[model samples]
Structures are given as C-alpha cells and as structure tokens.
Target: MRKKYVIIKVFKMDERGVKLYQPDAQIKKGWLSLWRQMFSELIGSRELIWRLFVRDFLAKYKQAVFGVAWALIMPLVMVGVFVFLNRAGVINIGTTDIPYPAFALLGLSIWQVFATGLTACSNSIVAGGSMVVKINFAKESLVIASLAQALFDFLVRIGLLVVVFVILRVVPAWTTLLVPFALIPLLLFTLGLGLILSLLTALMRDIPHIVTLLTTFLLFLTPVLYPVPQGKLFAILNRYNPLSTLIIEIRNLVIVGRITEPLRFMIISLFCLFLFLVCWRIFHLVEPRMAERV
Candidate 1:
C-alpha cells in the first residue's frame, strides 16, 4: 500500500522555516511576535505598496477620457436628483444645517469612500491575478494599494464639496477646523471592514459585486443624502448604524457646530479600532494561503 501525504503551507515561524500541523504543533512565536511581524512586513514592503498604488492609479485614470473627473460625477448626479425631489415634493429629505446641496454632496463624498474602498479592496486579490499566484510578497499591499484609488476619488469629491460650499456661500462652523481629525474614525472603520471583505472576496469571486450592491442599498437607509428624518424611527436607526454616526458627526463638525452624538461616535470609533486589529490578525493568519486561492 502507498502512503499518503498532506502538505500544509504556512508562514515561516522563524529565520529557519518551521511549519505547524494540527494538535501537536507548538507555536514558537508569541502573540506579540505575530503583531510585530505584521507591522514589520508592512513597513518593509512600503516600496512595493507604493509601486502598486502608482501602477493602479495611473492605469485607472490614464485609460479614462474623463480622467479623475469620474469621481465627482456620480455624487453630483445623486445630489441633483435628491434636490429636485425635495423641491418637487416628490420626497421630503428633511432639513440640513447647511444648504441641502452642500449637505448631500458632503455626505455622499464620505459614503462613497466607504463604498468604493470596500469594492476595491474586495476585488484586489483577484485582480492581481497571476501576480498573486507568483509573488511571495505581502498581499496586504494589494489591498492597501487598491484602497488608495478610492481615496483618490475621495480627494476629488472633497474639491467638489468645497465648490458646493462656495457656491452656496456657506461658511462652515468653527469646528470645521477639526474636520481632518474627525475623519479618522471613518477612515479606520472603512479599512477594518475592507480588510475582512477582502478575505471573503478572495474565497468567492462574486463577493465584490454583492458588496457594491449592498452598499448602494445601505445608502438609502444611511441618511447619506438627507438629514435624519424627524421622530424616533430614524434617530434610533441612525444611533445603531455606525456609518450614520460617522457621516452625521463629520458633517456636524463642518456645519452643525458640535457633535450631536459624541458618546455614540466615541463608542463606534473605539469599536472600529478593535475591529481593525482583529480583522488584520485574521488576514495575516490566512495570507500565506491567499496565493493559491486567488
């Protein structure tokens, strides 16, 4: 009878390659070491991450006649339709602290960052194609690089938001100075969800498409195009939805003078930090197997 063998691939435990197998395999590295390697590899791979970012960035805009302008187009159209409906009484989006156009555009800008980043990260590994299969480098770089494109889109939308503010002649609140700081939680939450979605997406090619559709559906529920409607329904709903809290508070900083839900925002931000660390660990653990799957 021929003996059978099962080969398992894993990250090396040390400078000398060491593999783990089932019950008897002892992990020589501590949890601190796991954390250290994750950061160290990411830091060491900075150049590769940059190269990937630039390659994808140029490849995306260079092929487009609209170039970077594509970023502002979708949100601009959404703002127009919503504003029209509000005026025509076809719908009531409620009142905003700023002009509705500025309000909706700003909200959409923030929301799209999450939407686009999620899609980009989810598709990243599969899009890397033969490179993922052949390369022995940090796969997280691909997710990060893809996410950069969404951020580029975000910067473009920021310019549009500024234009809307100017046209509306709305000077933002004094707290607007804190806009950059206020945005940290939003960015972290998006990255945390993006990391987890990327891993799921690698296992199933259809996952990215589903994420895009789901985010679009979520936009309606999220108060992105409107102020939260009156009554406990939306208030309670927004309270539970972390994305709603992030958008509303960031917009509040820009226009409303204070965070309406500071406690909730703080809680959500802390949760996002925890989620990011956990998701990152999961991604790192499974990264060695990603090449074969992708």
Candidate 2:
C-alpha cells in the first residue's frame, strides 16, 4: 500500500518585500503546523457556515406545516406520558424541586440540544452529498452548520418553558441566568462526539441511525424525566455520565440557586473541553478523505 500525502505551503513575507516559502508539517507526522491550518480554515469559513446553516434551516421548515411547533410538541408528548404515569401511581418519578411537568420539560429541552445536534451532525457529511464531492472547503462547516438547526429548535422551545412556568405559577431562581453557561459543556461534548461520528457515518451509512437509537435509549437512563435516584444502581451511572451532571446542574440552578456538585460539574466540564479538542483534531486530520468515503 502507498501513503497519501498533502502538501501544505506556508508563505511568509519579510521587510524586503520578498516571499519565503516553507513546507508545513503533517499532524500524522506529529507536527504542530496542522493546528494553524485548521484554525485558519475554520475562522475563514464563517460566511460559508452561515450560508449552509441558512440553507438547512430553511429546507427543514419549507415544506412542513407545523414548522417549529414540532419541537415543543414532541417533548411535551414524552413528558406527558411520564407525568401521567406518576399521577396514576404506576411509578414514582420522585419529587422535583418544581412541579414534575416543569422539571421534566426543562430537562428534556436541554437534553434535546445534545441529542438532536449529535444526530444532525453525524448525518451532515452524507447530507452534503453532491456538494462535498464537487467542492473544496472545510468539511467542519457542514457539521457545525448542522448543529445550528438544533439550536434554533432549542430557542423555539423556550416559549413552551415560559408557558409552563406561568401556568404552574413557579418562579425560577435568580441563578437561572447561569443555565446557558452550564450548557456550554454539554454543547461541547455533543459537538465533539458528533464530529467523530460524522466521519463514521459516511464510512458506514447506518451509523447515524444507530446514534439516534442510542440517544433515545439514553434518555431513559439519564434522568431527563425524573429526579436523580437515591442510592440506586442508577445513582452510580448518573455520577459518571457527563450528560446527567450537565442537565442536573442546570436544572438545580434553575430551581435551587446552587449546583449540587460544583466540583463534579467542573471536572466534567474540563473533560468535555479536552474531548472536544481531541475530536476536533481527529476530524481535521481525516477530513480530506471524507469526500471519497461519502
């Protein structure tokens, strides 16, 4: 087998108005030049990302009658089932700091940002399809643009959250302002996993479907619809699951004005940042080959 190489040119200009040309190092060859290359492309392609984001955002709602309402509807339907079950005493979801409906809805809204972003970003390369083969650009743009749709849906669902709060007559804690800051780690973790998964989904077409299925299963395990269980088997799972801590910390901030485990939250946030950096580098290194796979 032969190795494939990409030649990168680094151009520097000195005071004499002469150009100096040097060869950039490959990351696979364990060099730092690729980092500069990737950052340059990512920063330079902001307009391209916005264009792609707008195209996808419009395409999603163009033919749909309900449009953004589906965002609120789906979460409401899911939470409604749990609300009914708890009311019927078929299962105890445990007491929430706010009403159960409010608590579950808030958790699911935050969770959907990760779940939807993961599924969307994983499919992004394949969804780019013809354009990816025909054009040359940073493939990261596709995954990043795909994430914008989920964020739009998340903003739309904020209306439902406000409605729930008004109806239940529950006032959120002042620390609710910190919810967005807490969510930064969750978003980073999702984008990191999604960046790697996007490449995989191109190689194996079924990966996106599997990702969707896994996210659905994880909903039951991650305490989106219930309070953290006490000393149960799941408490251990919650203790380590980054998503659980992210969602729970945000929720507690909304209701209690405090984070239950500030140290744990800080640790998970750092892990998320590390994971995102590693995954981003992996994506940048392999992106040239993605066109062939897709």
Candidate 3:
C-alpha cells in the first residue's frame, strides 16, 4: 500500500464576507414587521407611557435648590419684573383697569405653560435617544410624557396665580369656567408645534438652536408683556400669531372677567386642530427614520 497525502485549500473570509453571503430577506421582513407593530405596541404599552410621564415630571425639579417651589417662584418673579417695568414706562399695559402685577401674572401664567410645553416636547425625542435606540416602547409616548410634565408645571403655576388673585382681591367671575376651554386650543397648538419641532430637531442638530432663537423672538411678538394694539400691524400680527389669539382670549376670560370675542376662540380652535392633524401625520412619517438618524 502506497501512502498518499492530500492537501485542501481553505479560503479566509473578511468582515464583509458574511454580510455579502447572507440573504436580506429576514432584514426586510423585520423592518416591515416593525413598521406594522408600532401602533399595536403603542396601544398596548399605556403603563410605560404613564411611568415615563411621571418620571419626567419628577425629573424637572429633582436636584434643584428650590425643588418644585421654583415653579411658583418663577411666575411670581416674572410678575414682579413686569410690574416694575410697567410702572417705569418701559412696558405699557395700556388703559386696562387691572393692576399691572395682576395683569402680568395672568399673561405669564398662560404663556409660560405654552412655552414650556413647546420647549420640553420639542427636545423629548433627542433627550430620550438612549431609550429610543434601546427600548421597544411607542416613541409617541415620549412626547406625551414631556407634555404631561409641562402640564404639571402649568397646574402648579396656576396655584400660585390663585394665591396672587386672592391677595389682589380680584374675584373670578363665571367666565373663569371658560379658561379651561381657552386652554384646550393653546395646548393643542403647542403640542402640534412641539411634535413637528421634535422630529425636525432630531434630524437636524441645528434646529434646537434655531428654535430657541425663534422662541425668544416670538415672546416679543406675543402679547404676554403688553396688550395687543389695534393698529394695522398689530391686527396683522394678531390674526396670524396663534399665541396672540390664545393669550388674548385667556386674559379676557380669566383676568378681565369677560368673553367679548367668542368667534376668535372658535377660529383658534379650528386652526389648532388642523395643526394637530398635520403634525401627527408628519411625526408618523419621520419616526421610522429617527432611530437610524439619532
């Protein structure tokens, strides 16, 4: 018997070799399944949504020196500053019979709620990037969580407003009931814008900076520190600025104890609903790409 030796050649594979050899059928199916699963998972995970909301609420003041008292303190400080400025002829409140401090407080209370809601919700997805990438819950829940925290802050600030109102001896009338109705459109409007901004900011890192700048400009445009004028420019600003109608309506019903313009409220409400639908659709469209981008 003759001994024979056989040599076999083995091919070495690079990192890309495995990927090239594998079929993408499972990957394509997975992505399709994930897209279909999003809505069902969102509906099924209400508990996680609530938990995230509560966590966000607590996180707002967790390590702060003043804790939640900062909420009450902030609006009070704003009212004080505006009152001094108005007295000094820096910012005029026009001929309104209400005291300057009270007027300022009322405007700040409503404006701060909307502003904070918009700010927090806009950064929500970016802030939750870690969870978004790692966790399997509904992404929309992040926006809801952020809004809930903002609402909590709003309610706390309202309590401070009640204290100030009591001290000022300004009795709220039946029109006070309309305050919540007025707030509905404002909330919807803020949440819509927040959703739009949140998704955009996640895609474009520069958006958050632009948003901050725009928010500062918007504050001056809004009638938070002064009454809306009746001039041509003011009229145009009021009609177009969503916050203008919302703030004016809130001040009229809550602080002024009257409801002189119901039609404006209806128009604002309709606009907010339209914005909500548009933002919701946009959010759904961009959400799939969020994890990939973030």
Candidate 4:
C-alpha cells in the first residue's frame, strides 16, 4: 500500500493581521431573537455585568459625604413622614399585624428594590452614553448592573428591619425564607418596565423626568405605608396593579407567616415573565439603534 499524508488547515488572520469572528445570524431580529438576546446577555455578558456593577457601586459612594448612608436615608424619611402623619390624624394607616414601623419599613424595602432598580436601569443607557457609543459590548449589562445598587440598598434595609423587629419586640415568621421567591417577580417586573423606559429615555431626554414624577405617585398609589384597603376604588386598583399584589404578599410572608393570595402571586409571576420577554425582545431589536439615539 502507498503511504498517504493529509494536511489540515487552521484559520488564521488575514494579511492585515485582523482576526474575524464568525457572524452570529441568530442574534439578528426575529421572534426567537428575544431568547437569543437573553442567552447572549446572561451567558456572554456575565463578567462585563459584574465589572459594571462594581464600577457603579464604588462610584455611587466614592465622592458622597454620606457615602453608603444615602441608601438608608430615603426609607427612613418615608418612615418618619408616615409616623408623623399617623400621629397627627393627617392620615390613617389602619391596623397592621406587625408594628407600624416594621410593617412600613419592610414594605418600603421591597418597594425600593423595584423603584430604585427601575429608576437606575431606566437611565442606564443615557447615563453611560459615552461608553455605549464607544464600547462594542452587550448593552443590557448597563441595565442589569443597575440592579446591583438596588440589591445592595435592600440588604442594608434588611439590617434596619432586624433592628425594628428587635426594638418593637416583634418576631418575623419562618416564612421569611420564602421572601426571595416573591422578590424574584418584583425584580422581573422592574426589569421589564425598566428595559422599555431605558430605550425610550435614550431616544427622548424627557422620559427620566417623567419617571421621577411617576415614582413619587406610585408610592402613594401602592399599599406600602398602609394596609390593603377594602374600598371599591382600592379594590379595583389592587386587582389591576401587579406591584400591589407582590408587595402585599411579601409583607404577609414576612409578618403574617403565609402568603395571603398564592394564586394571585402565581399569576403575577407568569405575567412578569411574559412581560420581561416581550420587553427584552423589543429592546433587543432596538438596541442597534440605541447608540445613535443616545
């Protein structure tokens, strides 16, 4: 038999010394692009997201006189205002199963996770415009990274919650471990809404100002400072409002030892997941144009 030799060729850079990566057709816009974008974003941008998270986290407290103290300030201010209002007969929070201070603070802590995360993620692209245009990287990292600040703030408030429990001589339920499941839907809801707002905010500068006003209005509309109302108006609003359901359930889990409405929370969880997918799809399709818009 005659001896035969085969030679294999390895892909090398062109004469100009530039390496070419294979184009990913799946990344283009389509119905499935949403899942592709999510996979790319979550899997591919893991390290980038962490780096951005760290950068934003450090920069947030770097030059501030109060440093991380600012994280606790807003919730404390709300607590004080509500306490004063309740005392002066200006407003009635009604009866809570737990102490008013702990009840309100617990609700506010979870609410801030949604509120602050939404606000930061909404401005992520606009705030990081210089880098958005200059860096060729996953844009969703900006939004995902913004959640780190909210999570950190939430952890700080949790410490305050423990103090309130101790001072008030109230014991939280064993069901507190289930709080994370409740929080996941809230995070998804915030991210879904944030992605839509961030895209719009990048294209239109006025969106952030509008978001600020909306956040203030939403706090009152939500049942954070008060017990869930039984009036016709509040009943209808709570029926339609997803945040109310999540917050109320989380508050119940922590204070009352069980979820008040398991079915409602399950529905909201599904809705939030669907909403996130739709928002991500729109964001993925529009992302190519974002650098120019910003």
Q: After superposition, how far is residue 185 of candidate 3 from its true place, in Å?
A: 1.2
Distance (Å) between predicted and true CA of 94, model 4? 1.2
For residues 1-294, write the lDDT of model 1, one tens digit per residue: 954432223344655766454421235545676688789988998999899999998998898999989888888898899999999999987767788898889889888888888888888888888888786788888888878788888888888888888999999899988877877777777777787788788788778788978998989999888887888887888777889888888888888789987888899989888888888887877766665666
Model 3 shows how many backbone clashes? Answer: 0
Model 1, residue pairs in steric clash: none
**Per-residue lDDT of candidate 4, residues 85-176 (tens digit):** 99899998889888788889999999999989999999998888688888877788899889877988999989888988999999899999
Candidate 3 structure quality by residue, lDDT tens digits, 60-166: 67878888887778778777787788779986678655666777778887887787788888899999968788875567788877877778888888787788778
The candidate with the higher TM-score, 3 or 4, is 4
Clash tally for model 1: 0
Candidate 2 wrong stretches, greater than 4 Å: 1-30
Models ranked on TM-score: 1, 2, 4, 3
Candidate lDDT (C-alpha), each: 0.81, 0.86, 0.75, 0.84
TM-score of 3: 0.82
Superposed Cα deviation of residue 136, candidate 1 (Å): 0.8
Question: Which lDDT value does model 1 have at 259?
Answer: 95
Q: What is every candidate's alpha-carbon RMSD to the true fold?
A: 3.8, 3.8, 11.4, 8.3
Clashes within 3 Å, all models in order = 0, 0, 0, 0
Candidates ranked by lDDT: 2, 4, 1, 3
Q: For this target, which candidate reaches the highest lDDT against the unseen true structure? A: 2
Q: Please identify model 4 stretches exceeding 4 Å from their true place.
A: 1-30
